[model samples]
Every structure is written in structure tokens, then in C-alpha cells.
Target: MSFAPFSDAPGTLDAAATAARLPWSALAEEIAALLWDSTVSVPARSVLPLAQGGSLFVMPATDRSVAMTKLITFTPGNAGTGRPSIQGDVVVFDIATGERRLVLDGPTVTARRTAAVSLLAARHLAPVPQGPLLIVGAGVQGRAHAEAFVVGLGVQEVWIASRSAASAEALAAHVHALGAQARVVADADAALPHCPLVATCTPAQAVVLSATPRSDAFIAAVGAFTPTMVELAPALCQHVALHGTIVVDTGDAGHEAGDLLQAGLDVATMPMLRNVVCGPWTHGTRAGKGPVLFKSCGWAGWDLAAARLAMRRAAAEPPMPAAAVRVPA
Candidate 1:
């Protein structure tokens, strides 16, 4: 049988390459646009247990132009092991041609896109968008959140707190390198009153942030994604539910938002990102309301948005030599 050469193969991107294409400002904008786009469809993600308490996740989303699937493994115990806790790849395909288009580094997409979601929430929820910030749990998400706030919100100062002093210091150094003042706080609760903006990005097996924030503070709780994990205390969640406004990233949060679910809150009735951004909902900041809590449970649509943005940025770059690409028969 004669073999015909396929001209195009999927382009691959490593961690740095993927991150380069997803700038904080641009990624946030893309996600915001997707929030209002009814054409995008995201199915429920499937999770299966792996050895040693790890989990394998399969998430898929599609739009008219492209389709994406993210396959990743999450190992919470990878901490201090020099191995990433979350590892995977996001595969993008052209819907019209049914051909692979891009393979993006999964960890980079998760960190950047997840942080961008928080940034979008802050834009609408934060009382004082520009200023000092507090990040609990100085890990990959913590670092991403710090950078996103610095670039997207023009935040000048950051306070980092973690159980591991070394990790907190390392994240602080990273934030310092980003031209923002960074401090490794000994106690997150003590630092809470000083910073109006807070992002909790821990593992969420236990409560990391329990203190009551300022009346106008904005808190993005993104650490825990499943029903079994939780980051905020039940009391804190209840307090926010009663006195403040709680916004969920998507409708899926009703089942996956561990903080709100564990707190015994009805997540289904909460305002979603679309409602806050596109609808006439002004309970959080306007009219001098209480604190705003943004609960993020993650949605595959966010990954598709990142893939779309990455593809657009890649189109602007110089193409690689055709010979460098390996096309299978």
C-alpha cells in the first residue's frame, strides 16, 4: 500500500512555552468572554483513584471551532518529593478537520488558567483591587496567584503563609522577583486583617484560613475541588453566606465545591461567574455589602479557553520547519 504524507502534525508546548502564550491579562479576558459564550459546552469531568491516594482526571470541553481534553494525575503526597503534584497534558483538536492541533503542558495550563479565573473573580468582587494581597499555602497555585494579581490587578505587596517556612520563603522570593514586595507571614490569620485581597490555594484536607476577613475583603477559595476536600472553616463559610456574597465559578460547583458543600451551604442557588459578570447582580461590592467569597471548583470550559488563547498566540509566532514535525501514516 502506498503511504501519503500528512502535512501538519500537532504542535507541542512545554511548561515554559505554554506559560508564555497564556499571559495573565489575556487569559483572564478569554475566560471572561467564554463565561458569556453559550456556544461552549463542558461535560462533567471523570475522576478515578490511583495508587497511593492519587487520582486520574479526564476533562473534556468543546466549542464550534475546537475541542479539548485534559488528562492529568493528581498526587497530593508529591509535596517535598521534587515531583509535581499535578501532571498532565491538554490536547486540542480542530473540530472541522478532526485533526490534532496542539498539545499544551497540563500543569502550566492548570496553574495559569486557574489563577486567571481567580483574577476575574477579583476584578468584580474585590473592594480594593489594587493593593496588598494575602496568599495562603505557598505552592504552585500560590505562586501563580501572586503573579496573576501582580500583572492583572497591579498589586504591589503580597503576604505568603504556609506550614513549610521554606516554601513560603521561596514563593516570597518569586513574588519579589516580579517587582512586588513579598513577605513571609508567620500567621495567615494575623495577616488577614491587613490585606483586603486573599487567595487560599492549599491542599484543603484541613482548614488553612479560618479568620474572619474585613467587611470589604475579597477571598478567592480555590484549593479544594472535590466534595471531600475543604480549605475554609465551616463557620467562616457560614459567616460569608449570611453576611456576604458567595460567587461560584460555574454551575458544577454545586457538586464539587468542597468548602461550600462541607459548610452546608446551598451552592446551587449561588450566583455564577456569568451572572456576576453579565447579569445585573450587585450584591457583593456595590451598595456597601459584606465580604465577597469566590468559590472555584474548576470547569473544563476554562481549559478550552486557555487552549483557544494559546492557539491564537501560537499563530502569531514563526512556524517551525515541516521536517521537524513527525507525521504518522
Candidate 2:
């Protein structure tokens, strides 16, 4: 069981391998344990604005055992250039030896971590994980959420929709291949009401989900990280009564998530996921309270947990095959 350090390119590590390494249940539990550990430290991530309306993010964290840093770049304009708007690399290193561990794909790690964190938060707020799940945006995060919520959490089924129908169909096919029941919807509105659990994964300036949501609905919005981007409508944000409070992955998300910021929300008062995971936060509901919201602005804590697991899983694998190149393993 040599879960040690190695050097690899950004995408040398496969997504399935990463997902397998960080199983949904174990990953969520480890994240909870990481939150429980008082010795671990994670500061606010570093952000630098790029000249082209994009931004660069430097996220670092450590459990005093494994240290990791993720260099992420978000360029909104890259949508038309055949390149994704979100791209980066996660670099993990050994704390004892100061040796570099492995480099996992940023988007791959981000997609899995974001969805898993959503699952973590959902465990506290949402009803039993056996209901329909509505996933907006048929991109990486959308597909990943289908895996997390349906395959990971045992959701009964998944409904996928996107701005592009072709993309939606593509994701639907992928989900079906996973042996999960899924279909492409015309838009999010049609599917939003039926599903009690929803994961919004998009970078839209306008709100994607509108109209009154179910009072008990649990939404996890992973996109719209910038102050200029908004996912949930301000109307929805304003109506969320105290009983069904908006949840966040980090303490400072209200400052970063455009949805909450635009809604004029006092995000400081919003419940943080760490508190919910650490302490006893009863999520029982009231009759008329608005829908529950869980918004994430990306966090270094999640990256560190995912990276450490990936490194250890890599080292534990059997010797690489002749047809396979040496990855982080």
C-alpha cells in the first residue's frame, strides 16, 4: 500500500479512476472527517483577474499529511474556441518528503468534487436520496452530478437539460450507459418542479430556474462563481424564508456567488456546509418556507481531499499494462 508521490500531466489520470478512488460514500465521509480535524488548515483561495475578462485561481490546502494546490483558469470567451471556459491542473505533494505527488485534471477533479460536495450538503437538507434528480446544463458538471446524485446517492432517476439539445442528448446517452434511467428535457423549467433534488451547473448571466420552486426542493448550484454570473433567480433568493435557509460550501460564498450577491442576501448569516456537517443541524421544514439553496463558489478544501485520495488510489493500483502509459500511478 504505497500511496506515495508521483509526477504526471494535467489529464494523465483518468476520470473513472479518480471517481473510483474517491467513491461517493467514502469521499463524503472523508470530507466530513477533514472538517472535523482541527489540525487541518484551508485559507481563502487566491484569485487574480486575467486581462481577457477571465480569472486565475490558486487554491491550496493541507491536512498536515498531504498538501495540494490547484491552478484553475476560467475564460468565459473560450466557449466558441473549441476549448472549455473552465480548465486547470491540480498538483498534490507529500508533506513529509516535500515530493510532488500527482497532477489531476482540474475540471475532472472539480466536477467530481463539486458534485460530491453537493451530495454532502444534500445529505443534511434533502429528503431521502431516492427521488428524481433534475440536472441543468448537460456539460461536465451536469454529467458528473448525474453520477453523484443517481449512481452515487441512489436517486431514482435523472433528468438532464441544457442550452444545447445535442449536448443534452449526449449526456442522456452517457447516463443511460451508466445503467441509470435518464432523459433529455426541453428546458429546466419543465423538469424542475417534478424533481425534489436539483443540481444547476451552468455559467449563465440570467437565472436558469425560475417560477416558484417546491418548498422542500434542495438545489445545488455549482456554477456562476463570479459576481457577474447568476444562476438562481433573485426572486427565489429573496423568498427563501429563514426556516429553509440558503446553504453554502464555504463561509464566504455570499461574497462570490453572484446569485446570492445580486439577490442582496446577507450571506454572512447563511449556514455554512462545514457547520452542518460538523454539528447537529436539524433540517426539518416549515409549511410555507421557500426552497432550500446550496451554492458553492469552489473551495480548496474539496480539492485537497480529492487529490489525496487520487494519489493513494494510484499507488495502490496493479502495475500498468503494456498498452498503458505511466500515469500518476
**Candidate whose lDDT is highest:** 1
Candidate 2 — which pairs collide?
A: 6-101
Q: Which stretches of candidate 2 lie over 4 Å from their true place?
A: 1-16, 284-290, 320-329
TM-score of 1: 0.93
Show model 1 residue runs off by greater than 4 Å.
1-8, 282-285, 320-329
Report, for every candidate in turn, its global Cα lDDT versus the true structure. 0.89, 0.78
Give per-residue CA lDDT, model 2, range 157-206, as digits (tens): 78887888888888888878877888778878877778888889986657
lDDT of model 2, residue 160: 84
State the displacement of the C-alpha of residue 93, model 1, in Å, after optimal TM-score superposition.
Answer: 0.8
The CA lDDT at 97 in model 1 is: 77
Q: Per model, state how many residue pairs clash.
A: 0, 1
Clashes of 1: 0
Error of 1 at 159 (Å): 0.4
